[model samples]
Target: MKPVRYTGLTIAWWLVGTPVSAIDVQHSSLVELEAAYAYKTGSWQKQEIVWRPEWVTRFDSGARLTVIGEGRFDAKDKLDPGRPDQPFRAQNTETVFPSDHIDLELREFYLDHYAGDAFVRLGKQQIVWGQADGLRVLDVINPLSYREFILPDVEHRRIPLWSALTEIPLETWTAQLVWIPDATVTESTLPGATYSLIPDPFGEGRLQVNRPDSLADSDFGLKLSTFQRGWDLSLNYLYHTIDDPLIRIDASGQQVLADYNRSHLVGGTASKPFGDLTLRSEVGLESKNRFQDSLTGEIINTEVGSYVIGLDYSGFSDWFISAQFFQTYRFTGTHDNGSSKEQVTVLIRHDAMNNALILEALGIYDLNNKDSLIQLEAEYSVSTNVVLRAGADLFFGDQSGTFGQFQEASRLSTGFTFSF
Candidate 1:
């Protein structure tokens, strides 16, 4: 997390409720959070506020070119320096501080050069490609923001990397592709419900964060799909070369060679609607040896391909009820070379209170290890664009055994989400 102070905050909303213009403002605070029992019996709870100003205007040029642009601004805790802090010292797992206040990044600024029913875009924009319940393996491209989560992920921030992607309709099939010259990785949050704090770039040498933002070499992929008998089939493939930082550190400690290869991911997921329930499932296998298959001096084995299987049911959207199960295993596991890890999660969801409340809880098990996890969640909408939420997550079964123990108990948290 960027260096910043956490105290009181200030925000202002310039309302322009015109049919073509919109603006919103909002704020919330949480006073307590939970960590392992040894860290504290509970949390000192932190507070935060965020305000956003948005405006949009659309025009048509002989119905050929559509131009649109939008601007957004964010001000939080030490961001304004006008508010004060709570009486005593507090412990916060939340990363909202003065050093990391949101800069009101651009949401969209592009022109649609439409010729018939298709067009090309040349500017900072969002490109989304995935069909799963947001747990995407094919969504390998796009800028990731480290700020928020929970809402639907329809897009990302404007990127300097221009994309030459398009969709062309065909008789029974369609063709699509996306390419950007300067591959990049925008810092992202690892699900706030799990933790609202930013982790160190390098912690005990975990490989997930160390993976290059840009896959060293440009990344690209292809997808194809078709519909039949209330059934649909789809396939996708992505290729790239990214370094593995942890591998390098480990090899240096002892002496070994490294061979990094271009990674490849080929997968397909399918779904169909059944009365009162939707049957959805996914299966995938991985391979990366084709690009880099050997290791030399200071070995950096950034190569891993895994297999996954998952199933979910959206039996109810009214009251919002859903259930899902997932399991992942790596065929090419490694540790000294690389090790395989497997995990599973059983989730349930509910939406009620005149459609004003949302609830979800998940039970997770690390099949590879004895550690297990439970997450409880709840959210209530105060209005169409305003919401209040609180939830906590608890982990059991000696977690400190890996990080070394202070306490091997829990990691509990709860907070709110609001948009204006």
Candidate 2:
């Protein structure tokens, strides 16, 4: 991989030059140490430490500036091998890798202000949509990172972008608008990484990614939300480039060409609570989704519809239970076997010892491939400023299946976080 250029140094310096006396600055920091062992391979898969620091400067004029930075030291160096290429809008937030095991990044930096009845946030940030926990239906604004597959929390997996967001309150409803100039698509693990998606049968050089670089390729979206009759609802729309690439084989059949395509996403979400149970649902229709035919190796353009229905129950004290069903259907294009896919996810959590100790289990089963992933985790708050965590990830089913293909990657992990 080529070294990504660092173009954010000037912006970083400029932000640092801001006057400190005129603002009320609040600061916090945390250190996290984690390690994972792959039982199948009988080898250490991860040994890393991370430090995150954040600052919020609030001015008397009702304007606020926020900045967050992250540094990581990967002793095993199995997740992120190096700094990937920067996106067009993210050039000012580039990540720097000093060595094979050390990385420094400007995670988020943004300014917030209120203009009359509108709330505006400008700079690099993250925008989240939808109500699903483990599955994505209408939440396509920010791209994702698959370095750890889908095992990590959504907040940790989402890649932030450089964008401008505005929110306006009108009567009983709210409207939000987002303009993202960041051309950063999704970031995938490299070939030799632990969670690489590409097979080793094809050389690493055989896969090529064509990223959009022009300003005209920017992404934009709008959302309208309201609460009425004890129900929360939203209407969402986005015109942007899909993060996942469409794969196609070259003419010589020796190379795989992957490219991003633009699409229009129309979706909505609704949630309602009934006594102890809450029902949530999200649905979206995406236009011009491309998929490759496994038999003929041809790219097929089609409309895709995806939806998720979830039920959450919290009747029992200190116990929480949630289940979700997700599905995706192609209106035109079909795989060699079918045009629809389905998944089910269940999550259970319990808090013990007056909420000091917590235990949780999450299961995701792919109905189409008959594969599944189970995650078991426990967390204990040692003190107000410290917490300890341990977890196990298990995968099952045939090797050709999605989760089953990572069966060998199953692991046990433990970590601790110290906040100050």
> Model 1, stretches more than 4 Å misplaced?
1-46, 52-55, 62-104, 107-113, 119-122, 134-136, 143-162, 186-216, 241-247, 250-261, 289-308, 314-331, 335-339, 400-420
lDDT (CA) for every model shown?
A: 0.42, 0.84
Best by lDDT: 2
Query: What is the C-alpha lDDT profile of model 2 across 348-414, one tens digit per residue?
Result: 9999999999999999999999999999999999999999999999999889998999999999999
Best by TM-score: 2
Point out where model 2 deviates above 4 Å.
1-21, 82-90, 251-253
* lDDT of predicted model 2: 0.84
**Cα lDDT over the full model 1:** 0.42
